[model samples]
Target chain A: MAENTAYDRVKAARANNRPTGKDYINALVDNFLELHGDRRFGDDPAIVGGVGWLGGVAVTVIAIEKGRGAKDRLTRNFGAPNPEGYRKALRLMKQAEKFRRPVVCFVDTSGAYCGIEAEERGQGQAIAENLMEMMTLRTPIISVLVGEGGSGGALALAVADEVWMLENSIYSVISPEGCASILWKDSGKAADAAQSLKLTAQDALDMGIIERVLPEKEMGKEGFYSVLRAELCAKIEELEILPLPELTEMRYRRFRALGAQQLAGE
Target chain B: MPFIDFFNFQPKNELEKGGRQSAPIAQDDNEPAKTCPNCHRQIPLSQLWGNDHCCTNCDYHFRMNSRQRVSFMTDSGSFTELYAGLCADDFLRFPGYPKKLETTRNASRETEAVICGTAKIDGRECCLFVMEPYFMMGSMGVAVGEKITRIFEYAAENSLPVVGCTVSGGARMQEGMLSLMQMAKVSGAVKRHSDAGLLYITLITDPTTGGVTASFAMEGDIILAEPGATIGFAGARVIEQTTRKKLPQGFQTSEFLLSHGFVDAIVPRAQQRKTIGSLLKLHSGGAENG
Candidate 1:
């Protein structure tokens, strides 16, 4: 492989694990400790959950994992979490409520893990349980999509107090290839389907599907950590003053508004 | 005893020299006759059932149960049902809803219209779901949505191809908005499954209508429909009444849908299994390499 090829370029860029979001949050906050495992079964590497600091306020963080290479991708299940991963996230979400800490999630995945083992392990029940549990989670939670945010894997995290996605990110129910195959019987028309499906950040914002869009220019891996850290700190500072009841109401209303289409009568 | 004497009935040609006394009964011309729905010929119930749910003369189509459909579409003994026990309760007190439920339950021996399961079609393992019109007129309700959602979720988790044999009158009227909510629920579930890069094919059957037609039924990765199947959203009468015009011939038929890009293929009943199996194999094979 050439040293300066596109793959190498992308690989080098991703090597900086301390993105702006993670770094700034770490430095500005204190006493951050991470948690793992679903307890019902095994732990999921795709979604990492734990108690972390934002300034002086404690918060729960759930992030979608992205492996650095093909081998790592296999290990991370290509960022698609199995049932145990969702279960682990569910466990942490409950803990966040117990300790009265706000939850923040970073979403970046193609979708949930699709494999024989995952189904045999009751994937449907797992996702259903997560949705049911999250619907009733008492703590205020926020989510941000740093990269590709495809379907329920993203929805698992995106259903929060506030949802944000970086510019250039895509959030869709299905990928263009899948849509094209269903509609045209030809996967080559994926580009056209992508245009029609309206899976971009701006399209989502226009449809009132999400709250905000984070600019991608200063959102590189290294820069993303700091920027996210700063944003989280500011958000936490703003949220700390609100009463629990208000936070609870806001969280409830936030999810209730998704996919609300314009009524014909209206 | 002769066949004519078995039913205590006389054969019309019993005395004819060349006519066999025990021959099958010949219809009497100008006599009180039950006209066949397809050919307008007088036929008995025994003949209709003996013809295997088809018009004896004109081959008119007949609605089938999910079990019958799966058998027709998959290899024998291949159906492994998913969410078999998900039944709807009378959550809302709609008038006569309980009676209607009881009637359909007794008639169809099923709790809901749709049955979701994994089956082998022409030797290819596939996750398939079939909707039978006998149960509650195949109306989509909470149970239908839950069952379908479970199917898609299972398909996505297993990296298996998903197939749906869709037939419905519309959303369940008793459930009202709850029924409407199922449109979103199933659509969302199908979307998630599709995003996982799994094959999701939909086979539209006769009388696919209303909210069912608007959502996941139309959102297939590859759509197919049975020949001559009626596939549309608005009822034929309602559309005609609203337009104040005569609709074109063959409107909303599977052939029409194929022409309008709503369906990929118009498959015959006997060939549906082979067609779907080939498509599944091709799609799954492609996925295996990647």
Candidate 2:
């Protein structure tokens, strides 16, 4: 195999054949019970979140599902959540806090859906509410970037005690094509945009934007699941030991210190 | 008076630029003559500024740059800028981004898109952050985010109220993820300010869309919008394309938002100072002078 460039990894991350959030839940969680509806509005299929057991500890599992087929993709809005989806995710998170269950979110989305209805329903407000609410949630949270973590949509679920990413996953503020179109007036320069964006998991880890990078090199599905499960279990155990106040403070401080390091380097 | 046909609206030319390209405000010749896009009436630039950038003929709200907005809102000679020293570097080293930033700096006469400071709004001291739409559509980048965070932090420390005037296209694409991160960074600061029980107000002007709308702009305790302002997360064209449906008449405008309960009030530019002062006074339990 040739060495993969950033753009190549982006393609790999977006590969339809690659395992999705539902696959991870099936492999990692025990007896997961899927929940739906935001209670304020109807259900949003783009975000799948519910209760499950992670290593004998009941936890809230929320993940963006791109869906399996063309029909499913339409149903899931190609993993781009509407305002209701975010609201649903937040509802589950609040419930998790009430039960003191740890939250484990899998982020994979092109972005929050940018449509007329979505905007009318307060897409920005939904994401904003989550960011503000997640900051002070008493329960611990661990977010994994499973695939395309694009913009505010991904960040809505990613403010956590630990944010991990799959090796090939792409996390960016805007998609390469979008950036290319905006910056160069051409979407064909996506490869160049990818390089400039520094959106690979390795770049994210190096920038202190993410906590860990899970390697998926040459691993079969079973092997990948085992590694992910083990790592997640370890992180959960480590986090569960800390007091709630300390964990919350740590989460707040982690985000607050983000751009300061880069600024210091300059 | 012409019947206000909301459905037959022509999208503001300023918003059509989408913050990527500089609008007509970039002209360096200091041309005194200007035309209102809404009414298509010729007016002197001085008249526009004097009217808080509203068209004299049709009362069309024109986008105000950061300096103009600050000067218009704050008490005379009371603004002490907080983070003027902070500037955006070519963090990603994207091609031509440095040159673009330099050009924008010279053109806008500002280091960054946002001007954050401590100012007196009708004799009430508050921490303020105003976005300059002239500077790359007032896109939120690292510096804009940091400045906003600093303002919130300062407001929290001093127990002062916060008044942010938002006008932006979205996050800066040149800075890539760095620009997007401002949403979270500024949102965190707003959270901290809210937790501190300090009053935080947001005034959406002309156009406030994208990541800025998704973050601090929507998190205000009292959300205010200029009449006729466009406030939404996605651009109108993007929404139209994605939904494959025509948007409703006056969609995303301040009047629409007010009816939908998204905005607390739709303030006309002339009455904004008095309205904001009254809100501050009410919050602070100051004696009502009216």
In order of appearance, the predictions have TM-scores of 0.50, 0.92
DockQ-derived CAPRI band for the predicted complex in model 1: incorrect
Candidate 2, B209-278: lDDT as tens digits: 9898899889999999998998998889878877889899999999987887788998999999999988
Per-residue error at B276 for model 1, in Å?
Answer: 34
Candidate number achieving the greatest TM-score relative to the actual structure? 2
Encode model 1's per-residue lDDT on B95-208: one tens digit a residue.
Answer: 456788899989899878899999999888889889988986688877787788778888888888899988998667554334544554576567667767888888888878
What is the interface root-mean-square deviation of candidate 1?
15.5
lDDT of 1 by residue, A167-259 (tens): 666666555565567557787876666655556666667756677887766544556556767887687677657787677556555433433
DockQ of each: 0.02, 0.41
Please tell me what DockQ candidate 2 reaches: 0.41
Residue A194 in candidate 2, Cα distance off native in Å: 1.3
lDDT of 2 by residue, A84-111 (tens): 9999999999999999899999999989
Question: Number of backbone collisions per candidate, in order?
Answer: 16, 0
Clashes of 1: 16
- Show where candidate 1 strays beyond 4 Å: A1-32, A221-224, A240-245, B1-290
Candidate 2's C-alpha lDDT? Answer: 0.87
